[model samples]
Target: MWSGDELDLDAYLARIGYDIERDGELAPDLRTLTALHRAHASAIPFENLDVALGRPIPLDLKSLQAKLVERRRGGYCYEQNSLLAAALERIGFHVAGRGARNRSRGAALPPVTHALLVVTVEGEQWLADVGFGWQGPLEPVPLRDGVRVEQDGWTFGIGVEDDGIHVLRSLRATGWMDVYAFSPQTYQPGDFTVLNHYSSSHPQSRFLGQVVAQRPGMDVRRSLLRETLSLVRADGSVEERIVTADELAATLEAEFGIELDAEERAGLERVHAAGV
Candidate 1:
């Protein structure tokens, strides 16, 4: 199942700032699921810095723990969700993987490059994903079609198409916007490895040459793509500005909570100076 036994559950709990003594014991229940999901989403950011630095993205549990939990760094989909899946599984939840197409980009059909999790609690399924940068749900969304849930001020819903694909949508100012869609077919860890290879290394992959980091919050969402940093509020207002190489590291740390070492900071600055 997601190599749950190998994960250091206590370390992960601490990383996400979840306190068992204060909150409660970890159990395979909805309350525990939602608490962990929200905490993980808020604590770990979503970033593709390693890919931008031309580093290999490893999906092993040990590597994920070392890079994300121990290093206090962020990662893109596979790394984020894989770590989450492991933690949830270790807590006795039934977690399964699913591959999704990126519909947020536009009408053009993108390949299935995103990885998410479906966890079953007391025979009910929940769509649990902490990887989808700014547009992701803060907590697990019910897998039922037409079910809508609001977290703080943001609203998200699930819809089923004629083909039986479940589409996750967010209620934007314009209207309901599709975030991403996935089928009923469950994916495996090996399947995510294949997708991760393409996303981390393929020349056409958007993560390859640019710096991308995102943090989602209740009232505001921040996104840094290459040199541009954009902040979008729940009311549809957006403020965007270009970030120079000199400000990249500080911006990441200040806005996304991503701390980079001297080498990473120097390398990313070079890339930012060159532009995407």
Candidate 2:
């Protein structure tokens, strides 16, 4: 029996631009691994438009799968991580869903603001992430603590801490900075819900006040519409332009693959008018 609230496997895969065999058997091997990488890279784009639109980001498998994979939506950490967990399990991969804290500042780390997958293949475990916006990993790497793995123009590694928490980071010009941390504890949907609500509702939350959206490809495309709209490329180059309501809608669709309704368009106009 399937978990009542679990996300659909086939639909989720299709949402990410992948077609699976309706009746053919899926084997656990490198072929499966490669397919997953391709789907993650191509199908679901990392984005934050829902938060800016004042819509509650859903963490349940079905809703998240619908938003990201069905309606062709984009989401933050919780939504993307949750759906990926469901898809990996449905395909017979041994997986673990782990919560992570963003401790880049060397503090006690924040709440469960991020998520990643741990899978055991051939007696080895690897960390897999496809939801992080611009700074996410492109492929799964060995889960060896404190070992560096080269990725797309970056180096990433995980560090095992004394408090039983694992720290993840990317190698920068200065040094290694903490990204997030996690443990072996399993995550329930409600955990993510609390964090999502806080991020969307809190007055201090950045998403509630700004228009931030990003799409990843050969380069990272980030657009921030506050005071003035700034479109930035991967190499730190930027293009500044003034946008009307129609132009904003067109930019959302053209840049982030997000289609807004009338209400959403009106809300976006309000944001633009407020100069935030």
Candidate 3:
């Protein structure tokens, strides 16, 4: 169970720009779930600057609220999904955690390093993830196998393999490409803590020595990996350019909506320069 009672519900709703008066009453229904999921995904970015900065990534509700909600910053899967799980639970929805393997990198069998959520509404389960970076879902995708949903212009589908592992795929120009896959096993916060350690600190972790930030939108998706900034449009067009250390701070704020403080900016700049 996520620690929902300890979260600042008002601040979180406000941070995501979800006004109860305008959006709708807070209820544990599909409408409310989709609205909140979309709002959160569009509002918060996905970044691993803390990992690159050599800072500890805490999973507690208070720390999550302080660093993500209050600070208006972004985080990777664990932090983003954990914060969302708390908010949804606080709103009276049934939420559970799941571990997933990264499949974007072709032919590589990585460990289960991704943390996502499965929310039940009216006895139906939905895959709600706000932390998959640029390839994440804007709204919850139903858990039904072979179900496909379109959000704005992007399309996502869910399929079950012979081993009973559910895979989430996206429709690229080439075809349906695997995004990530997870089993039916339910993971706990402590489980994510273990996974987070490897992701944030392990030398082989992709986030350890690089600056990564991503924002997924209806028209375009932006990704800042180290010094290269890439933009992919809905029509399958791609544009990329290198970002210098001098432009790192501005690029983060402008492209990914992540505004780092003085110390973080300096540290990230150094990491970017070294990585380049």
Off by over 4 Å in 3: none
Q: How far does residue 63 in candidate 1 sit from its true spot (Å)?
A: 0.4
Model 2 over residues 123-216: C-alpha lDDT tens digits?
7887777766656666676778778877545577988888677777877666777877788686665666676788778876656756665544
Q: How much lDDT does each candidate structure score? A: 0.93, 0.67, 0.94
| Highest lDDT scorer | 3
Q: Number of clashes in every candidate structure?
A: 0, 1, 0
lDDT of 1 by residue, 1-276 (tens): 789999999999999999999989989999999999999999999999999899999999999999999999999999999999999888899999999998998899989999999999999999999999988999999999899999988999999998789999999899999999999899999999999999999888888778899988888888998888999888889999999999999999999888989999999999888874
Give each model a TM-score: 0.98, 0.79, 0.99
Q: Candidate 2 — what's its lDDT?
A: 0.67
Candidate 1 TM-score versus the reference: 0.98
lDDT of 1 at 112: 93
